[model samples]
Target: MHEVKAKGILSAQNGMNIYKGCTHGCIYCDARSTCYQMDHAFEDIAVKVNAPELLEQALRRKRKKCMIGTGAMSDPYLHLEKELCLTRRCLEIIDEYGYGLAIQTKSDMLLRDLDIMKRINQKTKCVVQMTLTTFDERLCQILEPHVCTTSRRIEVLNILREEGIPTIVWMTPILPFINDTEENIRSILSACRKAEVYGIMTFGIGLTLRDGNRQYFYQKLDQHFSGMKERYIKTYGNAYQLPVPRGKELMKLVRQECSDAGIEWRTEKIFEYMHQFEDKEVGRQLTLFD
Candidate 1:
């Protein structure tokens, strides 16, 4: 990991990524796509040494409280986070400023900050978002080689549920011909229901492939699933979105399952929930003192 001084920390929408590049090694990472223009090796991990300080400044200047988001372009709980604690420091600042948190990751290390998350939720809101691509443990290892598997993430979700911290599941990038089966989708959705997740965000049954990520994904396919690359080339042939043949059917099932469980499926609504900030202390005062 290398340290760099960032000019700014939070986005106009209040999203932040404490680090650039990732070591989680997901085979189909869109962050590695050429459009993002990452300058260093994807695993080098550029650490924003000033992230906590910059976040504190940003939170102090804001006139109104809102949810602060992170882990969009890179997982904030990556292995480097264990030592650097940049994410932890930023969380402390958000808690200090009374802002909500909406953090996304595919790692189990989030348990390390469970106390901070509970503190934030008690004051305002804290939504933990976990991405589950496949339910089969062996397949999960092949797809997201370096991070925690789906079962462990489910455990994290259940723990969050018990802690009164809301959670969301991102069931995305369902690779065509690899993980786009009805059974796989059903299994993941079933697990989400068991975990009592507040919402499920899905973009149909397919994955996107671009100039940079497409090449790397194909290479891994050749390594793990022989002849899969040729099949993809023949089926997709330079297309960006690789929708599965059964995408429509699979998505219909997804909608029905979410409806049955009362878990949200609308992407916009879920995002609105994450961005909206509510102060429980203020609500309590209004209810009792109004």
Candidate 2:
């Protein structure tokens, strides 16, 4: 890990990335895609040493409170986070300033910050978003090698539910020939149901493969799943969005399941939930009590 002084911490939309690059080597990580223009090697992990201070400044200057988001380009709780504590420090600031958070990650290390997350949620809102790609443990290991498997994430979700911390599940990047199966979708949604997640965000039964992401994904396929690269080339040569043959049917199933369980599947609604902030600006005016 190397430290970099960031010019700014929060995006115009209030999103933040305390670190650049990711060590959680999900074989198909879109962050590694060339479109993102990551300067260093994907594992080097550029740490924003000034993140906490910058966040405090940003939160303090704002006239109104809004949800502070992180873990979009990189997981905040990557192994480096154990020592850096940048994410932890920033959360503490958000808690102190009474801003909501919508933190995303695929790591179990997030459990370390549960107390602070609970504290923030009590004051404002703090939603934990975890991405679940596949349900099979062995397959999960292959797909998301650096992080804990799906079962553990499910455990985290259940724990969050019990803590009154809302959660969202990102069910996405469904590889066409490998994991795009009805059974895979059903099993994942079943686990989500048990976890009582507030919403499920899915982009259909398919994965996008652009110039940079497609090359890396295919390379991994060549290494792990022999002959898979050739199949992908033949099936989706130079295409961006490669929808599965059963995509339409599988998406129908997902909609029905989400409807039955009352788990949100509407894309716009989920985006609204994430960005829409509550003011709670209802405190009484100061009084000397004379």
Candidate 3:
């Protein structure tokens, strides 16, 4: 890991990535695509040494309070977080400023900051988003090798629910011919329902393959599923969005299940929920003015 001084922290849309690159060896990572143009190895992990300072300055300058998002390109609860505490410091800043937080992660290490997240939610809003790809524990290990398994993530969701903290599940990158089955989808949705997740973000029943990520995913396919790479090449040569044969059927099933469980599955609605900032004091003041 190397530290770099960042000129700025938050995005125009109020998102922040405290680190560049990732150590989680997920084979289907889209961030590996050459389109992103990273100069260093993906695992090298470029740390923004001044992220907390920058975030504090940005939040203080904001005229209106809004939700702050992080962990879009890299997980904030990486192993290094235990020692560095950059993510924790940033969370403190968000809490101090009384701004909402919408953080995402695949690791259970987020439990370390449970107190801070709970306090943030109690003051405003704090939504935790977790990505669940494969329901099968063994398959999950093979796919997301470096991160926590599916069951453990479910536990985290349950913990958040008990604390009255809303959670969202990102059910995506369904690898065709590997995990694009009805049972796998059903199992994941069942877990989400049991945990009382606010929503599930799913594009469809397949993953994307581009120049950089495609080659790496194919390599992993050869290593794990022997000859699966050839099948992918024969089926989807040079295609970017790879929709599985059962995509339509699987999508229909997901919609039906989410509807039955009362979980939000619409992409637009979920994005709107995460981006919209809700302030009770501001709402009361506006009501008085009107």
Candidate 4:
């Protein structure tokens, strides 16, 4: 890991990535795509040393409170976070400023900051988003080798549920011919249902393959699932969007299941929910006086 002073932290849309690159070795990571243009290796994490300071300044300058999002380009709870605690410090600032939070991660390390997140939720809104690509533990380990598996993430979701903190599940990048089966989708949705997640975001039952990420994904496929690379090449040559053969059927299943469970399945609605900021403290203050 290397530290670099960032000029700014928050994005125009109120999102921030305290770190660049990632340690979670998810084979289908779109962040590795050359389109993103990272100068360093994907594993060599670039830490924004001044992230907390920048964030605090940004929040203070904001004329109105809004939801602050992170973990889009890279997971904030990477292994480096265990020692650096930069993400934790940022969370403290967001909570202190009474701003809402929408953080996404694949690691259970986020549980360490449960206190700060709970406080943020109490004061405003705090939504935790977790990406669950594969339901099978073995497949999960193979796909996301460096991070915690799906089952552990479900446990984290349950913990957040008990804390009255809303959670969202990102079921994405579903690799075709590998983990695009109905059984896999059903199992993951079942877990989300049990966790009482606020929503599940999935584009469809497939993953994207581009120049940088495609080569890396093919390499992993060759290493683990022999003949898989050839199959992919034969099926989707030079195609960016490689939807699963049964994408329509699986997507229909997802919609039906999510609707039955009262979980938000529409992408637009979920994005709106995460972007919208709610101030519970206002109601609490009114209640106290009454």
**lDDT of each residue in 21-77, candidate 4, tens digit only:** 999999999999999999999999999999999999999998888889999999999
Give a tens-digit lDDT track for model 2, residues 1-290.
89999999999788999999988889888888888888888899999999999999999998877788898889999999999888999999999988889999999899999999999877667889999989889999989999999999999999999999999999988898988988999999999998889899887678887767677788889889999999888988888888999999999999999999999998878877877665445542211111
User: Which residue pairs show collisions in model 3?
Assistant: none
Candidate 2: segments with Cα more than 4 A from true spot: 279-290
Candidate 3 yields a Cα-based lDDT of 0.90
Per-residue lDDT over 1-290 for candidate 3, one digit per residue giving the tens place of the 0 to 100 score: 99999999998888999999988899899999999999999899999999999999999998877888999988998878989999999999999998888999999999999999988887778899999999999999999999999999999999999999999999988999999988999999999999999999998778898889998999999899989998998999889999988999999999999999999999989987887676755552111011
**Candidate 2 clashing pairs?**
none
Which candidate comes out best when scored by lDDT?
A: 4
Q: Tens digits of per-residue lDDT for model 1 on 1-290?
A: 89999999999888999999999999999999999998999999999999999999999998878889999999999999999999999999999889889999999999999999999999999999999999899999999999999999999999998999999999998998899888999999999998899999987678999989988999999999999999999999999988999999998998999999999999989988888888898783211111
Each prediction's TM-score versus the true structure: 0.97, 0.95, 0.96, 0.97
185: Cα error in model 4, Å: 0.7
Candidate structures ordered by lDDT, highest first: 4, 1, 3, 2
Model 1 residue runs over 4 Å out of place are 284-290
Cα misplacement distance, residue 287 of candidate 4 (Å): 24
| lDDT by candidate, in order shown | 0.91, 0.88, 0.90, 0.92
Q: Count residue pairs with overlapping backbones in model 2.
A: 0
Query: How many clashing pairs per prediction, in order?
Result: 0, 0, 0, 0
